[model samples]
Target chain A: METQIDKLEQNKKSKEKKTQPEKEELKGTFAAVLIVGGIILVGWLGVFGLFLERA
Target chain B: MHLHRYEKIWLMLGAGGLALFIVLLCVNAFAMGMAPPSNMEMIDPEKVMETPPFDKPGLKQVGDKEYDAYMTAFAFGFSPTKMEVPAGSTINFHVTSPDVVHGFQIPETNINFMVLPGHISSATHTFDKPGEYLILCNEYCGAGHQVMATTIIVK
Candidate 1:
């Protein structure tokens, strides 16, 4: 019985390990998206401001 | 080709970004009437000095609040170096280079273009604010390229 329980726990741990890297990758991608979006937004605002100031 | 789900998502996002950029550019060009310089008119570079408009390079009042500014770009200077126009006046600039390629740019406005020999570049801008706008040549012409500048005084 003890050996069976250990085997089941090991299987669960392995499954979790397989998904951990994917979760980290998704987080990194989300961060990259947010950073890019922020930069674009700032650039657009700066251009619009310049146009209004000069034009 | 087999693509991972993340890769497919990234591909779609990149395509969408490109499409958005192109659409915005088109709208700004067509709908907003913001376009780059075009060489619709042509002229003889040698005879540019004798051309009707180029022959008279100065500000001429055309209408109630409209003016036609005929300008010539040379080796290291521009004709009609100093000009004064009324505020809230629409000025049409017809520029040409008589010697070599040059640049025509008016700081603090959307008036920037290249002056190519044998080709005429035109742009229109209204001076709504009363200020001094400096015109500078961005292209390298010769030794005196640094001094190739003029000013437009809006009163």
Candidate 2:
């Protein structure tokens, strides 16, 4: 019974280890998307401002 | 795939931003009447001289405080190079090219468009301020492209 409990604990630890890199990858992707979104918003606002001035 | 809580939130926000951009563009174009040049009017490049309105290229009073300016662009020169219109008058510019492609751009106003050989491009603007607006051919047509300019005297 002790050996079975030890196996279960090891399985849970391995599962967490596999998910560690996945979480990091997701974080990187989210940061990249936010940066791109911010750039697009700023560029669009600049263009709209120019349009208003010219029009 | 199972998305994390933060990832799902970010995705929704990104989609919402994109939607907002599209809506703004639509409102500006349709509601505000801002648009690019359209190819609605066509003419024969070789017979541009024989055309009715272009044959007599000049400004004509169409209504009270409104005028129509018919213009033709050819090989580094515009016909009726000097134009005069009353201040606070709305002028509808009808422009076409005979020889090659050129650009009709009046500085300090929203009067800029491509003058194609067989297409009649047009734009309308009201000159509220009485000033001389320089009309320049923004497109490079030939050697004399530098001097391809005129003046619109708004008085």
Candidate 3:
């Protein structure tokens, strides 16, 4: 009976594990990408603004 | 592939940004007519001086406040030697090169174009402020390229 109880507990833990993703360390990747993209967008907009002002 | 959630967001953002740039460029270039200076009129390089319009390299009033300035860019100098415009006058500059390539640029204005041997390049600018504006050759044509400049007196 104890063995059966332990098997049921193990089954429950495994089901919880199935719902979670494996740990992948992406340290500062998202922030770095956003900063770079922001820089490019800002620079492009600045140049476009200058063109419009001059044109 | 199992992409991370933030990765997917940034990827979509990047694609959207690129698409935005292309759309803006197309709209400004086609719809708004803000394309670069391009005068498609071609002439015989050998007969640039003999050309009817270019032969008379000077300013001619087109509208009440607009002038069509036909000018030639030669080996080391520009024809007509001098020009003067009234304040708030808009000058449409049609420039051509007889010898080699040269740059026609007016400082503090949006009139900058290349004068090619067989082609005419044109740009327009309004002289709103009364001052002496310098039109200089920005290309390295020869030893006298630095001296290839003229003044447009705006009164």
Candidate 4:
């Protein structure tokens, strides 16, 4: 009975290890997307400032 | 804060669209003769080849029987606000801008170039036909861009 339980625990650990890299990759992709969005926002704001003279 | 997957995608798209809009506006302005900041100094197109005379009382002359003139364009003003070139004489134009990229053109003569800040652009023309040549800033520089047009007389 002890060996059976041990086998189940090992299987679960292996599954987690296999999935860990995918999770990290998703996080990295999300970060890249955020950075690009931020850059675009700043560029637009700068152009708008040029036309902001009060009449 | 935690954003849902769809929300994140939409946010990024919105930001990208804003950037594209700004870029397009600038491009449109330039195509419409609105001047923008440049990397060169602005010189009046009329000042080239003509030098004020030390012996004469008023403005000097750089050439024989030719008077000095200037055609300056800027975000707000153009120097030598007025000019009259003699008919049948080669008039050298020294065109430049003070703050941005201004275009100098005499549509009748087909003269055009970018007036970069901190740089001098020279163009020469001999008016064979006597008439009024319109000077229009072909670059969309700012608010007054539409009314930035002026005139040059070639008699």
lDDT of every model, 2 decimals: 0.87, 0.87, 0.86, 0.62
**Model 4 regions more than 4 Å off:** A1-55, B1-60, B65-68
What is the DockQ for all candidates, taken in turn? 0.17, 0.33, 0.25, 0.03
Provide chain B's TM-score, model 1.
Answer: 0.91
Tens digit of per-residue lDDT, candidate 1, span B51-93: 8989989999999889999999998899998999888999999
Here, model 3's chain A TM-score works out at 0.56
* Tens-digit lDDT track of model 3 for B59-134: 9999998999999988788888999889999998888988999999887777788889998887888788899988
Ranking by lDDT: 1, 2, 3, 4
Assess candidate 1 and give its lDDT: 0.87
For candidate 1, the TM-score is: 0.80
RMSD to native for every prediction?
6.5, 4.9, 7.0, 13.5
The number of the candidate with the highest DockQ is: 2
**Candidate 3, B-chain TM:** 0.92
Q: For candidate 3, lDDT tens digit of each residue in A1-55?
A: 4798899999999997876544655559888998898899799889768755654
Per-residue lDDT of model 2, residues A1-55, tens digit only: 5798899999999998887644565667778888888898899889778756765
The positional error of residue B12 in candidate 3, measured at the CA in angstroms, is 1.9
Per TM-score, what order, best first?
Answer: 3, 2, 1, 4
**B35-112: candidate 2 lDDT, tens digit per residue:** 676458999999999998999899999999899989998887888889888889998889999899999998777788
Per-residue lDDT over B1-155 for candidate 4, one digit per residue giving the tens place of the 0 to 100 score:
55566556767787778788789778878775444324244434344224222112122256764554445567765665666666766665655555677777777463667777656666656667778877788888898887777666777
Summarize candidate 1's per-residue lDDT along A1-55 as a digit string, tens digits: 5798899999999998886543445657756876786698799889989877866
